[model samples]
Target: MRLKGNLSQIKNSRDNQNVDVELYIDKIEYITNKKDGRYTQPFEFVDELDTPLVLTGDCLARVQDKHLEEGEFAYQVYDKVEGEYVLNPDKYLELTVAYDFDADLTILTAAYYTVTVSNEEFKDIKAERSKEKKQKKGKGRKGRS
Candidate 1:
């Protein structure tokens, strides 16, 4: 139910204004009831952005146009299970959101279909090179102890 990610205005190959939205999904937790068997379970999206990006009418229009031309922004949803961001096999989620040029990014409806990437695939999404540790030279006497 919660959406967290970066949304910005960028120029496409044609030099036209386009909106770029990428989410940094934290988790979608299940609310349980102990007393009775729960039938309806609701979830919410978490806002993990430090500083929100502002959307302009022109930008929003362009985004909509782009969406119509291409498709909705596919997002990768990650669920924090135990201590890691695990992926839910469910490929699509409905989220309704509004990008206001004058206000902080907020979801107006919370219902939009978004594509997701699995945890295993996410690791390969952005591979970072591990830094090699520097080996220390022995301080003992070079010729004698």
Candidate 2:
């Protein structure tokens, strides 16, 4: 499974002494399974991140871009059938992404999310990240393009 997204928020690290322990919140802009190609499959990150999760991919979701036929929409969990980055209308997926600094962001973890859960949970989690980001702003963290 390969995911492309932006770091939308953060929870910071629970441990302050260790700068490596920091949270990077993300919004998944594009997702694909290189192995399956056509069929959507579950991706497990149990061995990869501080928070482990399983995601159900939507294989039929197809869209031209974020803008739908109706209006603008940022579609997540896109299935690459013949071309790339498409979404199945009925099929649903939401991911809250984070980083694995050890791998220099080569590895990432995405926790499953729902609209209801995010509204309440995001406020609590984002607060934690604010402090850490400020404290370590000019420390050792490198920028990514």
The numbered model that scores best in TM-score is 1
Model 1, position 73: C-alpha lDDT score: 38
TM-score of every prediction relative to native: 0.24, 0.23
- Give the alpha carbon lDDT tens digit for every residue of 27-55 in model 2: 32222222368775533211223333333
**lDDT top scorer:** 2
lDDT of 2: 0.35
- Clash list (residue pairs), candidate 1: 1-44, 1-45, 2-44, 2-45, 2-46, 94-112, 95-111, 95-112, 96-110, 96-111
lDDT of each: 0.34, 0.35
* Per-residue accuracy of model 1 over 47-103 as CA lDDT, tens digit each: 222343232212221122334322233333334457544544453333345666677
